[model samples]
Target: MPHINLLPWRELQRKQSQNKFVTILLLVVLVSFLSMYMLSTYYGNLRDGQNIKNSFLTTEIGHLDARIHEIRELDKKKESLQQRMRLIEDLQSSRNLGTQIMDEVAKIVPGGVYLTKLERRGSAIHVIGRSESNNRLSTMLRQVQNSYLLEKPTMQGIIAGEKSSRLLSDFNMEFYVKPFDKIGEAKQ
Candidate 1:
């Protein structure tokens, strides 16, 4: 039989097995690195997608906020317009009230009573005049009480002067002038 070199053969087999183990370890490390890289890339893409959605939502919310502001401004303008309209209607309705009050005053005046000065403050009327006699003044007061456009005619003050040829008796009287039915009643 030929003599076998077992030492060299065993050494060669040990070197081959060590090389195989190193290669398998390097392959496992490479596979782990690749998987980590893929996972990182996927998470980065997902974060980027989420950021984009957030940006879009922010833009849409800005538009909605602007619309809400515009609507509030329009509502304020509408309220102002409504107030102006109400003021205009009130003015229109009371347009003829002054003339009517004057007409009523003329109708209530008795004969022999002449007004020298007339002043109006709100609904009150101040009359400074001369009457032919005290009886005439009483008659004028009675007429004012019975008239349609005068109420609560409280005689505030009365002054009498010496009798004169041109004027019968000097007097001063203050009374109130009432307004029309609906418009005046609502005020009270």
Candidate 2:
């Protein structure tokens, strides 16, 4: 028989099989690492996009807040102007009322009676005056009742003055002034 060594060849074949296994394992590990890296990059890009959207929304909210503040200021100014206009209208109406009231008061006063002091509280008029006698006072009350400027005249109080040489008698009266439509007409 011829002398032949097969042991070395068998050892070489085994070594080649081990090398193939190691190469396949290394390839699997590299593929898994690449997949993980790609997934992480995709998630990072998604987070960056969300952050950009949030910033844009924040800027829009800020602009809306400013507009709301400006609208509130304008509303305040409008209210102030409306109040001022109302006050001016009231003043103008009162100016015309004063003239009408004075004319009515002049027409109601008797020739002999003289008014010393006149005061007004709301719609009420308080008059302190001197008259010749009680008859004159009665006539004055009647004149006030018949006057177009006075309404619901109720005698509040009356007192006889002490004997004096002065031609004037002492008396005081309070009544309400009738509001006329003409006074309110000026507002229109």
Candidate 3:
């Protein structure tokens, strides 16, 4: 039999196997590092895109807020103008009140009764007058009660006037003016 060196051959085989394992390990580590870098880049791009969208939305919201503020101001101005218009309309509608009151007084006065002072406060009319006689004052009171515009006639006081040639009576009276809406109903 020829003498063969099997030990050296076995040792060479072992070294080759060790080298192959180290090469595979290094390849695996390199591949893992590349995959990690690629995943991080992808996530960073997504984050940047979301940030841009958020900034756009914020700008749009700011514009909408400005418009809302302007709308509120316009509404306030509109309400103020409406109130002024309503006040003017009310003044115009009540313009004939004084004339109506005077006409009513003229119609209610009796022939023998002369009004000296006529004062109106709110719904109450205060009348100071001189009458030819007590009967004339009583007739005036009855006229006031039957008037469409007057009601609740109250005689405050009556006194004999100065000792003149003719007997005269001074009287103070108060009556409430009926509201225009009720005047027609009262007459009916």
Candidate 4:
């Protein structure tokens, strides 16, 4: 209404607004940098914690690996010891087999049958003997067949030898010896 000059007032108001905007921008820039630094610190702490856990897991894995190797060694030793024990057991079981077989043969021989040779080859016994007559030789074979320790009695040969006081027949036989446990079962 009045012819008033308002240019200086508008210029001053514009300068004040510009000052306020600069102040607000400076505060915003400082707050942004501070938030970024805080976020970076938090992430770095999280990364350090994860690395520590990973290192602990790796150490535990190494210990477990060592224990596994020890267990494998123990298993091998156990297997070796078991094999030795089995061999000893086998030797122990067969220790008196020869004596037992000889005793049984001596007991089962009938009268007047003279044994010339008694040898064992594997599981079989080879016998060479002289008898007064064929009947006595057959009796010996029957005794051998009925005995508990012998099986599959087989006569290989019989030759009429020269008279030695009486008629003598040379004979050879072969038979398999039964296992001790099997003989015991037969006795029962």
Each candidate structure's count of clashing pairs: 0, 0, 0, 0
Ranking the candidates on TM-score from highest down gives 3, 4, 2, 1
TM-score of each: 0.50, 0.52, 0.56, 0.53
TM-score of 3: 0.56
Model 3: colliding residue pairs: none
Error of 4 at 140 (Å): 14
What lDDT does the true structure give each of the candidates?
0.80, 0.79, 0.87, 0.88
lDDT string for model 2 (52-80, tens) is: 99999999999999999999999999999
Ranking by lDDT: 4, 3, 1, 2
- Between 1 and 4, whose lDDT is larger? 4
Instruction: Estimate, for each residue in 43-115, the C-alpha lDDT of model 4 and write its tens digit.
Output: 9999999999999999999999999999999999999999998778767867877887888898778888899
Inter-residue clash pairs, candidate 1:
none
lDDT of 3 by residue, 1-188 (tens): 47886989899999999999999999999999999999999999999999999999999999999999999999999999999987786567457767878998898888888999999999899999888887888887898888877889999999888867356788999999887557656757
Error of 4 at 83 (Å): 1.7
Please list the Cα RMSD from the true structure of every candidate, rounded to 1 decimal place: 7.0, 7.3, 6.4, 6.1
Q: Which should have the higher TM-score, number 2 or number 3?
A: 3
lDDT of 2: 0.79
